[model samples]
Target: MGESGAGPGTVRPGGRTARVRAAVLQAAGDLLAERGFDGLDLAEVARRAEVGRTTVYRRWGNPSALAADLLSDMADQSLPRTETGSLDGDLLANARLVQRTLADPRQGRLFCALIAAAECDERTAGALHRFYRTRIAEWAPCVEQAEERGEVPPGTDHAEVVRAVSAPLYYRFLVSGDPVDVPAADRAARAAAAAARAGAFTR
Candidate 1:
């Protein structure tokens, strides 16, 4: 909703407005990584962003709305999926990307914080779900292409295969406390590919 100035959750226009939004979101991310959602104060974000408090308040209303906008911005700016000509290769690329993001010091903590926020906040949870949907949709075509090549059966749940590639990596990131390493990523991709080959993802 924070893409225009039409309502309480609206973002701003381009040029200076876009710059302001970028700064605010960056600050929000940094704060979330550092102090988490409970510590996300509008005034602090405004101070960190060097924007007026009124601007932050008017544009994003509250911390939940600001976090939602931050998630939306992340989705909009995320890189497109890699196409590797095969389901395994494409899923490996997807798995590697997710692993890298989860292993990054700042990004890992930021994601953990956002996920924690989502557990107790409806708006943040919706935004988090939307963010994953965008990312999954970007990668779903890889499975569709695999289906075209008969690597997987028809009516396969392309999105589910994509999710399967990342699920283990996220488990390492958010739960098991294990290393989210390249080897783990490779295993995840391979496992998902094997599952899809067996029609585990078929509708």
Candidate 2:
């Protein structure tokens, strides 16, 4: 909904364009994490990225657009889902990945800022939703594989199972202010795996 109708940061540029995008997105992320959405100045971003101010304006136009594009870039750069043989193992792997990310100081702050931005900006919210959807889609296959192996009942909602694994971690990260640690991740994975096996996510 911001900038181009095709979606922010959807273009796959090459050569200098690719490098410019990489730099601009990096600068945007740093600014968002540091000064937040309210302070994300396109001119500052251009300066930090060493790109022309006109280019940043022409490409992104506004702070929300820049934030959306950064999110899109992050989604594109996220690691592929892990393939453990069992649902339990896969969920644990997924939980650990999320835990590690949220527990990281820089990444944690970056996410907090992005989530805060989403609360007030529709463009950022759409990008945030797309980011989660992409990540969920990446991990949902684990639940499908588990269904094939009879680890869970048939007709399980794969996306919900994957979402269940990350929900608790995010709750702690964004709300409860509890420690986002390995043990918390382990608990989340076990709980989600149990719930899925109990047919709680049946379609």
Candidate 3:
């Protein structure tokens, strides 16, 4: 299906690739949200994307791979980092976004299911790891800005600070069945900011 000299024309090589990727990702996401990881079928995704089965298989390979790309797409489309000019402000924004996503019924369950699946599947784990890496990197810049503003100590490990911001949300997502509301977002933000203020992110 994909080997018939498609010339990647149908896929737009670059632009088309992005377009088709978006379509496939959107379809895959809908399936994931509706069906969970186990229910996502590549064939259905191909049909929905109006792309060839070969294209779907050759491009993404498997359900886990598709799920990985789906997450990647979501991260790419996520809102740009907020620049609040203060440690608490920036951290709260990050925390709030994360909490809101995880607090959503479908998104939260999908993530929990994906993480659990990743624990036993290497391919899924790799994708999930890359997704988290992208997310953490996306939000790391706020911490760097904070350091430049003297809100936190110099040489703060921005990535760690970002990770800290997400720790509680992830904890709540995985450890407990508690609702990750606005207050939880605030707590995570404040806790991470406090730790960074005390040099937890230094080094």
TM-score of 2: 0.93
Per-residue CA lDDT of model 3 for 1-93, tens digit only, reads 000111111233368777888678767766776777788899998898888899999998989888777665555555677788898998888
lDDT of 3: 0.75
The parts of candidate 1 lying over 4 Å away from their true place are: 1-13
Shift of residue 85 alpha carbon in model 3, Å: 0.8
* Full-model lDDT for every candidate: 0.86, 0.85, 0.75
TM-score, one value per model: 0.93, 0.93, 0.83
Let me know the TM-score candidate 1 reaches against the reference structure: 0.93
Candidate 1 whole-model C-alpha lDDT, 0 to 1? 0.86
Q: What lDDT tens digits, residue by residue, belong to model 2 across residues 1-203?
A: 01111222333658889888888887887787788889899999999989999999999999999898888888877878889899999999999989888887667778889899999999999999998988998889999999999999999999999989989999998899899899999999999999999999998
Q: Give per-residue lDDT, candidate 3, residue 85.
A: 80
Per-residue lDDT of model 1, residues 1-203, tens digit only: 01111112134567888888888988898899899899999999999989999999999999999999988888877778789899989999888888888887777888888899999999999999998888888889999999999999999999999889889988888889999999999999999999999999999
